[model samples]
Target: MTTFTVNGRTHQPEGPSEMPLLWYLRDLAGLTGTKYGCGLGICGSCTVLVDGQAARACLLHVGELEGRAITTIEGLSADGMHPVQLAWRALNVAQCGYCQTGQIMQAAALLAATPKPTDAEIDAAMSGNLCRCGTYPRIRAAIKLAAEGGEA
Candidate 1:
């Protein structure tokens, strides 16, 4: 059994070792917040936190994740008030809402590593996450808002 921690809970994946972490998370763990956009690791829609850093769940295999700490969007905050999430709500960042969870996860990781990220830094960090609804401006604004302690 490949045991790993997800959302602060231990999980033993029962599928093949090569199964993507996205499947392990959604199919098995029932955490659907992390999406499957392109499945090619280019869209960043399946982003999640692995050991407090943003990782592409579509490309990471379960076998490669043993012992790592995985955090999905659902695990970001029990009260649904993580600063990034709050900022997302405050700035009205979601359009279709399909990609918001991954966007939030990536933003959370960025804010965690760089609490006050500059505009260029925010752009660089959020470059990979694609939003088909074209919410880039709002997303950047929300990131700055979250950094500035703007709560929902």
Candidate 2:
């Protein structure tokens, strides 16, 4: 069994170690908010925080994440009101909305790592997460707003 912390709670993964964390979270754990897109690390749809760092769930095997703290979008805010979430909402960041969860989680991780990220830093950090609907400007604005403690 692999023991880890998810959303501030400890979890024991009983599935195969090679199982991707995305499957464990959605298939076994039922945390569906973490979206599925490219299924590759290329898209950030599966982005989650592994030990407070941005990680791609679709590619991160459960065995690799053992004993680590994983934070999904659900863990970002039980109240649905994290600064990033609020910013996303205020900016109307999603068109398809399928990738927003991962996008926000990635942005949250970025903000956590760098409270005040420059435009280049934000772009550099967010480069991996592809937005099909092209909401890049809004996402950038939201991250900046959230970083400044503003309500989007």
Best by lDDT: 1
- In model 1, the clashing pairs are none
Residues 53-142, model 1: lDDT tens digits:
999999999999879999999999998989998999988899999989989999999999999999999999999999999999999999
What are the per-residue Cα lDDT tens digits for candidate 2 across 1-152? 77898999988888689999999999999999998888888989999999999999999988887789999999999999999999898888899898999999999999999999999999999999999999999999999999998884
Off by over 4 Å in 1: none
Q: Give TM per candidate.
A: 0.97, 0.97
Clashes of 2: 0
Say which candidate scores most in TM-score: 1
User: How does each model score on lDDT?
Assistant: 0.93, 0.92
lDDT for position 90 in model 2? 86
Evaluate model 1: give its lDDT.
Answer: 0.93
